[model samples]
Target: KNKYALQLDLVKDLEEAEARLAEVEQKLDPVGDYVEASMIAAASAQFHNVVAQLRILNPNVEFVEDGLDEDKE
Candidate 1:
């Protein structure tokens, strides 16, 4: 298997899921909203699920945001 390919594919999923999660998290009032809070919770769960999947694919591989995270590599 191509490790780069695996990483590339899942990183995209992680990014998308994280984007959705962050969007809802930033826009919603977690303490005052119920339905919107559920949406945030769902998105958050999805983001973590993708991270779990990536780790399962390769426990030693590191996950990073392509354009958003600090680079030392």
Candidate 2:
């Protein structure tokens, strides 16, 4: 089995997924009265989920945005 190729594919997939999640968060940005509290919470949850996945992919990777609780408050 070509383990290197498999690893490369996995890395590519993770990068793409991260990009898509970021785009979702960007789209969810509050805009006037069209935004709701529930939507903000959902976006926050998705962002945390992505951070968790990234950690799983690379245990040594450190994310500054993962400390989002302080920012949210």
Candidate 3:
């Protein structure tokens, strides 16, 4: 029973962390045009790193790819 409670607590912590991350992303979204692109690129790189770590930690989980082009040969 204690292990189950710990697991639930960990899941809650993960959810809160994700929410805080989204809040940070929202705050960063409204910068002026001159810096927005660079900021977004940096943020994307950081997000990718986090995702890679998550994948390593949860090897059984699969991630879906987006924006694949069919025309490219």
Candidate 4:
């Protein structure tokens, strides 16, 4: 009974914390956020291209990222 009560209290606390985080995230700096997102996107594309080129250069080698095959399984 005490354990169940503690679990319920913890869940309620987590719900409150998540609500606060959502409220704070809603107040982000718009221009900074957009610029940061764009930079991340550019970097991701460049990384993807490099990985593709590496695959082409070593066709027989099955890399961990060959088909983004690391964490899928």
Tell how far residue 2 is off in model 3, in angstroms.
56
**Ranking of candidates on lDDT, top first:** 2, 4, 1, 3
Candidate 3 worst ten-residue window by lDDT? 64-73
Please give the clash total of every predicted structure, in order.
0, 0, 0, 0
Give the per-residue lDDT of model 4 (tens digit) for 1-73: 6999999999999999999887776677534686677777787788789889999999999868555523232
Runs of candidate 1 exceeding 4 Å displacement: 1-32, 65-73
Every candidate's lDDT: 0.76, 0.78, 0.75, 0.78
Per-residue lDDT of 70 in model 2: 40
Backbone clashes, candidate 3: 0
Report the lDDT tens digits of candidate 3 across residue range 1-73: 6999999999999999999987887677655564665767787777778878989998999976453312234
lDDT value for model 3:
0.75
List candidate 3 segments past 4 Å from native: 1-32, 65-73
Q: List the residue pairs that clash in candidate 2.
A: none
Highest-scoring model, lDDT: 2
Candidate 4 stretches with Cα past 4 Å from truth are 29-73
What digit string (tens of lDDT, one per residue) describes model 2 on residues 1-73?
A: 4999999999999999999987877787736334476767788888889888998998997878746744353
